[model samples]
Target chain A: MPAYRPPVIPASEITPRSVYLRRREFMGLMAGAGLALGVGDARAEAPATVPLKTVPGSYKVGEPLTSRDDVTTYNNYYEFGTDKADPSRHSGDFKPRPWTITVDGLVGKPQTFDVDKLIADLPVEERIYRMRCVEAWSMVIPWDGIPLKALLDKVEPQGSAKFVAFETVVRPKEMPGQSGYLQPMPWPYVEGLRLDEAMHPLTILAVGLYGETLPNQNGAPIRLVVPWKYGFKGIKSIVRISLVEKQPPNSWNSLQANEYGFYANVNPGVDHPRWSQATERRIGASGFFGSGRRPTLMFNGYADEVASLYAGMDIRANY
Target chain B: MAMARSPFVDRLTGWGIYVIGFVPAAASFWLGATGGLGADPVRAFEQTLGLWALRFLILTLAITPLRQLAGVNLLRFRRALGLLAFWYAAMHFTVYLTLDRGLIWSTIIPDIARRPFITLGFAALVLLVPLALTSNRLSIRHLGKNWRLLHRLVYVAVSLAGVHYLLATKVLDLTQVVHIGLVVLLLGYRLVRSLIPRPERRAA
Candidate 1:
C-alpha cells in the first residue's frame, strides 16, 4: 500500500475564527449604513448571525463553509419531517442533552456511554468537509467531533465482526414524524459501514458544527460523518453502534433498495433513478433561485483518501 | 323563468372572477419579493406557483361539471379560468427554466428526458399552449367547429398535471390523495355524462 499524503488546502479557502464571528457584525454595519443612506431595500433581508467557533482540525477542506442559516435551516432529517426546513422548525423542543449511546453486537466489551461523558473523554477537532446529499445538493460544513476510530477502539471489535451498524435515537414524542402514521421511512434510521470504513481516518462522530454544540436541526449531540459517502450515510442523533458479521439493512436501502443502495458512496457515474447525479446545487453560493449547478465529483472529491477501500469492488454495481 | 339580471351585475361578476383568479399569484409574488419564502426562497416560489397552477386547473375542470350536475352556470367564466390556469402554469415553467435550471439547455434537456415527473409537467405545459393561443374571440371564431376539438386537449393536460403533482411530492399524503381523487371524479363525471344520451327536448 502507498503512503497517505494529505491534500494541500490553500490558506485563502479557510475562514478564520475572528472573521467568521465578525462577519455578522460587518453585515449589520453595512445594513445600517444602507438604511441611513435611504437604500433600505438591502436592509429588508434579515441580518446574518454569528456561528459557534469550530476550531480547525487535521482533516480540513480548503473551501468556505456554508452560512450557519443554510446549514441549520436546510436539512433532510426525516425523523423530524421530510421537508428541508421541517427539522429546524419541528426539532426546537427536542432534548439532546441527557443522551446515551450503547455499543454491543460482536464487540469484545459491550457498554453504554453518556454523550457528555464521551465528549469529555475524547478530544474534539473541527473538520471542514464537502457534504453531498443524494438529492443533488451540496454544502461545505465545519464539523466538530472525534474520529469514529477513537470510539470504536474503546469497544474492541471481535475478529468475526465484518461491519458496523448504527442506529439513531427514536423518540416519537419529540420526533413528530416518527410517531405519525405518515412516516417518511422506517423509524430509528439505521445505517452501516464496513469495519474498515468505520475505522477509516476520514470518518468522524461529529458532536457539533461551526464551533458550537450541534443544533437540534443539525443532528444535535452526535452524528456520523463519512466524507466520501452521501450525507444520509451520516446518521444523526445516533444511540446505538453494533459490530456485525453480515451487511445490515439501512433505513433508505431497506425502504427502496433500488433507489438507495447500501454503499451510498457519492459516485457521479451512478445516477439516482429519480434524479440526475451529474451536478449539484451549492446551498449558499447562489442568490434566491440558486447559485447554479457544478459538476459532481467522484466520491464527493474525497476519492484520494477513500478510493482504496473500493479498489477491487464494482462501485457501479454496489451503488 | 326568473327575470334576467342587469348588464352591470353580469360585468361585475365577470370582473370579480378575473380578479380573484390572480390573487394566489399576486400573494406568491409578494411573499417572494419580500423574504417570507424562507431559506430556499426560489424553491418556495416555484412550488407556490406550481400549486396555484394545479388549483386553477382543477377549478377550470370543475366548471363544466358544476353546470351539468348542480345547474351552476359558471360556463361564462370558464375561458377566463382556463386562461388563468395557463398563465400560472407558464409562470411555473418559466421559474423552473430560468431560476432553477438557469436556462441551461444542456441540463434542462437531460432533466426532461430522464425525469418522468419533469417530462409529465413539460407535457402538460405544451398541451396548454394551443388552448391559451385560441382563447381569444378572434381565434374562437376562426377555428369554429375545430375549436371545441382543439380545446378537448385540456382534459389530457389536467390529467398529466395531476400525475405530475403526485410524482413531484416526496410523500403521498391525504391532501395529495384528495386532490387527485377530485380530479378523477371530475374527469369521471365528464365521461359518464358523455356516455349517457340526452333526453329529446319537448315541444314548447
Candidate 2:
C-alpha cells in the first residue's frame, strides 16, 4: 500500500481570502432567498461583521487552513450533542457573551477575569495548526489566540503545581445533551495538561477563527488549542483553570481510561482500540472512498517542537 | 396458504418486500450524494448499513416467534427477509473493507484478530454465506431433512451479530440495549418452544 500523502493543491489554486469571503456572502444570500420562499429556516448567522485583527505568529504551518464551513459545521462539542451537526444546530441558543474564566488552585494570584478583559490584555496572533481527531480524521485550522503562557504567567503557578486542569461550563438548559437522562458524557467536560505543556509557547487560548469571533459550535468566547495533541485535549468553552499537584482526571480518561489517555498525542504507532491510527481521512478533501487518507504523523507533525516534553516516557503506555 | 391466495397479490407482496428491502441502501446512497450524512459521510454510510443489517437479522429471527405465539404466518416472506439481511451484511462488510480500511490487508487481518467486535461480525457474515447460497427450492429438495439442520446456523449468526453490535458500540445506550434485548427474547422463545411438545404440523 502507498504511504498516506495529503493531496497537494498548487499555491495558485488556493482560494484567495477575498474570494472565499465573497463565496460565504453568496451562500448567505442564497440561504436568505430560500427562507423568503417559505422554505425551512436557513442558517442566517452572518460571518464576523468586524474582521478579527491578528499579528503574525511564528508557529504558522505551511498547509492551507481548512475551509471555515468545515471547521464550523464539523465539530465535536459533546455539550451540544454527539452528532457532528448537532452542535451547529443546537448551539444557536447558547450564550457565549458575559463569560468569565476563573483562575485558581496552586497559583500565587488566583483571580476571575471577564473573557473580554482576558483577550484585551494579550496580543492575539494567527497560528495555523494541524488538528487531529481521535476518530482518525484531521484538519488544518487557522486560529486566532494569545499564547497560553501569557495567561499562565499572570496567574503565577506555584512550585507544587504539576498539572493544569481546565473545566467547561455546565448549563443543561443551554446545552441540550446535558439536560437529558441519557448522558453521553459526564457534566462539566474537563481536560488537563502537564504544567510544562500548559505553559508551552505553542499552546494557545483561542478566542476566534477564520478572521472572526468564534462560533458557538466551535467553542465560542474561549477555548484551549493544544495543536500537537488529539482535538479532545483542547477542551471548549472553558470556565475554570486550576493548577493542581496531582494528575487531574479528564472527561474522556474518566469515561474510558484504556481508550483515552491523559497525553493524547497523535502517534501513528499506537492504534485506537477500535480503529487504526496510522491513517486519517481528511474531511472535505475528496469523495467518500476517494484519495483522502493521509498518514497520521507523530504529535500531529509537531514532534520536533513537542518531543522533548516526553523524552523518557513510553508513548504506547502513555497513549 | 400462499398458493391459495391470488397469484397477483402473492407476486406483488414478494416483489414489494424485495423493493422495500433496498430502501435502506438507496437512502444511504441518496444521503451521501446530497451531503445529508453529516460531516463524515463515509462513516455515516457504513454505520447506517451495518445498523440496517442487524435490524433485518432481528426481524428475520422474530418471524418464528411471531408465528408460534400470535399465529400470524409470515413464513412465505421469511426467505426474502433472510436474503435481504444477508445482502445488507455483505454490503456492510464491503464498505468497511473498501472505503474505511482501503483494503489494507496487513492492518485489516490484525484488526480482525485483535478486535472481538470485528471478529464476531465477520463470523456472522461468513455463516450467512452458506445459508444465502442454499436459499432456493432446489437446494431444499436436494438436502431434504439436512436442510433444516443447515439453516439452524442462522440462530448462531444472529447471536454473533448481536454481540458484534454491542461490542462495537461500547456504550450501552438504550438503542443498543433494546436491540440486544429483542435478540435475546427471540432466542429465549426458540429455546422454550423447542423444549415443549407440539402437535404435528405440515412444514412449509
Candidate 3:
C-alpha cells in the first residue's frame, strides 16, 4: 500500500489545533474540541475499544477517560431537563435496552434492528471533536463511535429518499421532559438530514462516549452525532429514521423556525438571535486549561469540507 | 426604644440574611444548569448579579423610606444589607471581567470604552469601594459628621448602579422597570420630605 496520502494543502501547512478541531467539528464542534490535553487522570482507564488507532495526543493510545465535570455537569441530553447540567445529574433513568429504529418510508429492506445488532457491524473509533453549545460554551471530548454512512449503507435508500428523519425514545418515566410542551407531543424526538449530509463521512452513529457505555445524559444506546452542525442536530436516544422527499419538521425549527433551521451548522459569522455566533468558549484547550475559553470557528471550522455541498445557495435562508 | 435582642433572635436574623442572599445564588445555579440562563450565561450572570446589586442598593435606600412610612425604623438592618449589596456587586464585576471576556484585557478594554453601561458599571463599582471601606463603625466614628456626608454618596452610587443594571440588560424587562420605580420612590420620598418645612400652625 502507498504511504499516507497528503492533504491538498500539506499537513504541516494547517494549524494542527484547528485541523484537529475541524475533524471533530464535523462531528458537532464541541464533542471533543480541546480535550485530549491530559487523559492520564487518576481514575477509571478503560482499554481503548474503537478500531481506530490513537495517534500522538493527550489521550493514551486507545485508552478512554472522561472529565468528571463533563460527565457530571455539562450535558446536551434534554430529555431529563433543559439545563446543561440537569441532564447529567437527572438522565440516569433513560432505558436503552429493547430499542429499535424504524427504517421505513424511502428505504428498501425496511425493518427494525435491535441497536446492538446494528452496531455489531462497525467498529467504534475514538475521535476528539469540538462540541459547541448554542449558548457559546464548548468542550473538546474524546468520543467513541462509527461513521453514520456505514449504517445508512446497510439499509439502502431509494432514489426518492432525499431526507432522513430521526426520532428519540418516548417513555415518560425515563425521560420526564416530554410533558413540558403544552401541545400534543410527537411520540419520538425527530430530526432530519438532507440526503447528501446524511452520506457525509464525518456523520457518526455514536453508541458510547468517553470510551464507556453512554451515561443517559450523553444519549445512551444509540444516537446520531453530526459534528459540524449545532449540538441540537445530533438527535439522542433515537428510535426511528424515516427517509422522505422533503424536510421533516425539526424540534427547534418548529418552535422557532427562523432562529433554528434544519441545517444548524456552526458558523461564527452568523449570529444567533440572542447572542453572537462569531466565537465560542472552547472548553479544554491546553495552557488555557483551567484558565480561559477559546473563540468559536466558522462552519464550526469545517467550511472547507461541507461548504462545497451548498455552493450557490444562500446560507442565510436555510439558517 | 428597647434595644434588647436575645441571642436567638440575633442568630435567627443572621441566618435569615444568609438564606435570603443564598436564594438568588441558588436560583442562578439552577437556571444555569437548566439552560434557562439563556444562550449566553456570562451575560445573563452579569445581568443577574447586577440586578442583585441594585436590589441591595434599593434595600439600603428603602431603610429610611420604610421607617418614615411605617413609623418603625429598621436602621439596624442597614449595614448587613448594605454589605450584601456590595457582595453581589462584586460578584457582578467578577463575572464581567472574567467569564464574559475570558479574562482578556483586549476584549474588556473595547467593551469598557465603547459601552457606556460598562463604563457606568465600573464607575459605580469604584465609588462603592469608599462606601464599603467606611462602612465599619471605626471609620464611621473617625469621620464624624463627615460620615453622614460620605454615606450620602451611597445614594449617588445606587442611582448609578440602577442605571448600570438597566443599561446593561439591553432589553426592557418589567422587573427592571419595577426596580427603577422603587429607586425613584425611595429617593423621591426623601427629596419630597426634605423640601417640606415643619408646618407651623397657619392661623388667620
- Runs of candidate 2 exceeding 4 Å displacement: A1-51, B170-174, B195-204
Task: Evaluate model 2: give its lDDT.
Answer: 0.80
Q: Lowest summed lDDT over 10 consecutive residues: which window, candidate 3 chain A? A: A29-38
* Candidate 3 residue-wise lDDT, A1-319, digit = tens: 0111222434343444223322321332112211221122222222222333222222222223335444445666556544454465445555676678777778877878787776665677766666666766666667667777877777889998899888887765556444332112244667989989989876777777666655667777777877678888889887888889998878767655656788988877676654466555644232221224556777766677688888897887777
> What is the lDDT of every predicted structure here?
0.79, 0.80, 0.65
Steric clashes per prediction? 4, 0, 30
Highest TM-score, which number?
2
| DockQ of model 2, rounded to 2 decimals | 0.13
After superposing candidate 1 on the true structure, give the runs of residues whose Cα lies further than 4 Å from its correct spot: A1-55, B1-19, B192-204
Fnat by candidate, in order: 0.22, 0.19, 0.03
Model 1 error, position A293 (Å): 2.0
DockQ, 0 to 1 scale, candidate 3: 0.08
Tens digits of per-residue lDDT for model 1, B99-135: 7767778878998987888899999999999999999
Best-fitting candidate, scored by lDDT: 2
